[model samples]
Target chain A: MTAVAGVAMANEPISPIAPVKEINLAQVELGKKLYFDPRLSKSGFISCNSCHNLSMGGTDNLKTSIGHNWQQGPINAPTVLNSSMNLAQFWDGRAADLKEQAGGPIANPGEMASTHTLAIDVIKSIPQYVVEFKQVFGDSEINIDRVTEAIAEFEKTLITPNSRFDQWLLGDKDAITATELEGYQLFKTSGCVACHNGPAVGGSSFQKMGVVEPYKATSPAEGLAAVTGKDADRFMFKVPTLRNVEMTYPYFHDGEAETLTEAVDIMGRLQLGKKFTDEENAKIVAFLKTLTGDQPSFLMPILPPSTDSTPRPQPFD
Target chain B: MTAVAGVAMANEPISPIAPVKEINLAQVELGKKLYFDPRLSKSGFISCNSCHNLSMGGTDNLKTSIGHNWQQGPINAPTVLNSSMNLAQFWDGRAADLKEQAGGPIANPGEMASTHTLAIDVIKSIPQYVVEFKQVFGDSEINIDRVTEAIAEFEKTLITPNSRFDQWLLGDKDAITATELEGYQLFKTSGCVACHNGPAVGGSSFQKMGVVEPYKATSPAEGLAAVTGKDADRFMFKVPTLRNVEMTYPYFHDGEAETLTEAVDIMGRLQLGKKFTDEENAKIVAFLKTLTGDQPSFLMPILPPSTDSTPRPQPFD
Candidate 1:
């Protein structure tokens, strides 16, 4: 399949960015509730928010994700931040859209390990969810697709657009400090913009992390080789968005870098074939901090009990 | 300390409900951001909403909770639906208050398992959270207590006090159906009111599921006995608030009942010391549906880059 370059190489001819349908407020509300609801998980303890916590970066700090059996996952958790802009999902780019990605974890036997049938059954059991889903998706049969659709609708609303960089992009020269401005210039001059410039900044491309110096393969860190198993694809992974780079830490796919500066410096040696002076690195870090944007906080529910027990899946085994 | 009764039970008589401090909108906003933030979890895959989901009764609906390690928990996942009113935290009544409970899951080896100190350190590392906390807690040392208090404040806003029953209590007689009215009478006459009736309904007390009869236990369905180890408490569990009962299902502590009728029959045989006639049971169930309230839905977040990544206690060894 041809790769879409809506945000990557300028010469690649940006394909028409897929128009995202506006999310209905009602659907978003239902989806938001679903996002926080734990009934989606097989074990009931895990929810989408448990790992994609709102307090920290959208990604957890662990090198590899832990799932239902406490079995360690094979790779680091990807940030849900600006994930909507990505053409494909996961490091291997397995799922085609966020909706498809939503279904993966629920039935992964780890993560949520929840089944589509079980998820719908759980929602249908809740008279409230049943009503909401019917209202949003219509009286159509409730299934994993609808569940994914509703959640995707809600997730689509998780847009972190319009950061200070966006403001600068909009010609708000004062939006960023002079140091940050210089850092931005350095970023471009240093060739960081070759792949890292876009609406989502970096999600638009996939690149080998160590282009100048080959990335050493670790027993566990298969990188792109794990996805394609192509010798040339070694140490390649999806380039992450740096929109809120300041907040995302322990940078890199393996979470090996404890700070963004370290990651930036490492990238200079590996990807850019250059070196960043300490001051340059410090200024870039400062500029990245400015990229942080305002986001909606977690909204708690005002749930009233069903007057009676309603039909639902059994909560326990 | 003497246990207070009703809403009065929450406050020390001398202190007046502990002088419930108003939550800072800024802090609450910050906490809300934190709530949806995924970096708090070890895998960056789950967030607070993962389990205490807003859509499906503020619970994931599993008998046992799933965690970072993807391990199954030993008890039913309780709703964060109206948890602020819970006198203590967890089914075992392990935590004394919300502040204490907030940190529990984050640090529990079976739950988030994020260390309190590490959680603080992580948040502190984020310049925005540091700024937000300073503004919210007013320089009152940014630590676990402040974090919990901020989150708890946000949680307090999650009040489910607008049910039709509440409206009826406030003099809206037409708010309920005739069957619901009859069920209300049966609810009181059948003695379910002895424990399940109150402003928060059922949450005010702890009771045994099978009072007049002994019921066989299911897998991981030990009930409160697991906490207290008292013979009388073996089948006893927290009297869950039936406020959002219809939305929260897999009835009872173990979530064994899939339908309300089954739950009603079980409750009748065990707790009420009699069989529920089909008509009576139907009326009771009808009344339960009336307890369902109109909860506003959430606006989906437009996908944004999340910014938290501090070391949290790893759930898996």
Candidate 2:
């Protein structure tokens, strides 16, 4: 590893995002096929990649995702990139980990709308998938837990590493522009780094969306309160990772902030109770753009054809 | 290349499908990004891969494609695999080549529903795409022609080579099962090889869907009649490639035949005016399975993010 002077120091609040070094090749391969296979959905059209698109920075790039039957999701779809670093998955931190979170959307009426039993049946019916499951898990029995576990394992490998900011952190002084450097300094000094610190840059803990003042938005989500049913947890969401925040836009839980500049402005006013000049906002946006890293690269998995015995996808019915 | 007793001889009707030998790397790379980039669609949720999915035998695996606003398309989507081998594009042969065909769905109201002008506008606004276009095309100018041309270049490389049948034809006697070999002999003697010949096994010419009997289908498509404006061309459609026919199920122009057996049975009755026994149909299906070649392999392209200046996708509108 390159030695840096000021950044990634022992006392530094944030750490450099690390690249995946090792994983079970068989499990990862199986998970990738399942991730792209849309037959898991009721309509046979929605895969895990449909919402968390790897082609577009692990997001669908919509304000809120278009789900089953074109139902608009209540909250913005979070980026699956580097999500393992988060305190928990989802804005509410409802699921404790990626494994638990993987099962939610498949059964959600507005999302994939597939029962766990149906999803398992679909996978089990495919001979190739069945062979793979037996090879990976040492048994032919397919279940929701094993399915989600494999998916989560694949999700762990979705981290983006070697960003320009990461380069600068690892002792390369010329990695970032002067404007971006200024923005980084301002970002830390302005107290934005308090919650938004870690390898993922924000997923370390939960924080209120509006700290100093109340946030006004049309979204009806109660954030952590929805999970805990506690009045105090209202508006408390897991702080989203700022890594690759430029691409994963229409920011925040509600997706009300369409641009980085607007999101920065809103964050300053509602969270920190401070207003930033246009110049500063532009610099921050520029700095945020530098967070885009090398995305995951792998051959697109070829899914096995469904057999006559396989339950057909009832798209219309 | 291997020598076989009778198959792949100079006088043989069938030829082996060859792998892509040459291509422009830059153009293919850029085209791949565009193919998977859903931002080209009105909803930012549909791309070339949506209907002609790489994961699912280069098809959506639907009877008819689900298009923009959930509108069901008029005809079944043809497989993009080895489509360049076709005499022309689309079932009706309306578009002259892959390049022409690439632009159709983008603007089709029921499909992607994005006009050429709007699609160009979207691409032009993304700084990264602009830079890549200039690098690949050697110009700053972005247009529909160049866009489609690049996409067509990529499609040319999507050929599936080295199928078991091809191996058997290349003189690997054990490559195929005995039943499959028997079916191949039956296929040739039964005159099924007349239209389904050449490397792609079918795309060399256009043929009447029902040569001896009227085909019963609900699709209103008049096949080549729409292009030629002639009564004789009413049921004449471009012969689809039998390559990977096992995966490209729900066969026939209208996707009315849901299985290989059903399709084989229909073709026997309609085109040849002969009925195949159950044993013969099973053997043919087994032979068809041998046509599933090695699928194309490439890293999934990471698409450039849409900029703030880019027009936002009007999914609901």
Considering every candidate listed, which one attains the maximal lDDT? 2
TM-score of chain B of 2: 0.97
Candidate 1, residues A208-306: lDDT per residue as tens digits? 877998765453665567767798877667788776666566577776676778888998889988889999988877777776665545554443333
For residue B139, model 2's alpha carbon misses the true position, in angstroms, by: 1.5
- The whole-model lDDT of each prediction reads 0.66, 0.89
True contacts kept of 2: 0.74
What is candidate 1's local distance difference test score?
0.66
| Candidate 1 CAPRI-style tier | acceptable
In the range A1-317, model 2's lDDT, one tens digit per residue, is 44445535555666778767777778888889888988989888899999999988898889888877777889999999999899999999999999999999999988898899999988888999999999999998899999998998899999998999888887777999999989988888888899988899999899998899899879999999999999999999999999999889889998888999999999999999989999988888888888888888899999998998778776666
CA lDDT, candidate 1, residue A231: 84
Model 1 TM-score, all chains together: 0.79
What would the TM-score be for candidate 2 when compared with the true structure? Answer: 0.97
State interface RMSD in Å for all models. Answer: 6.5, 0.8
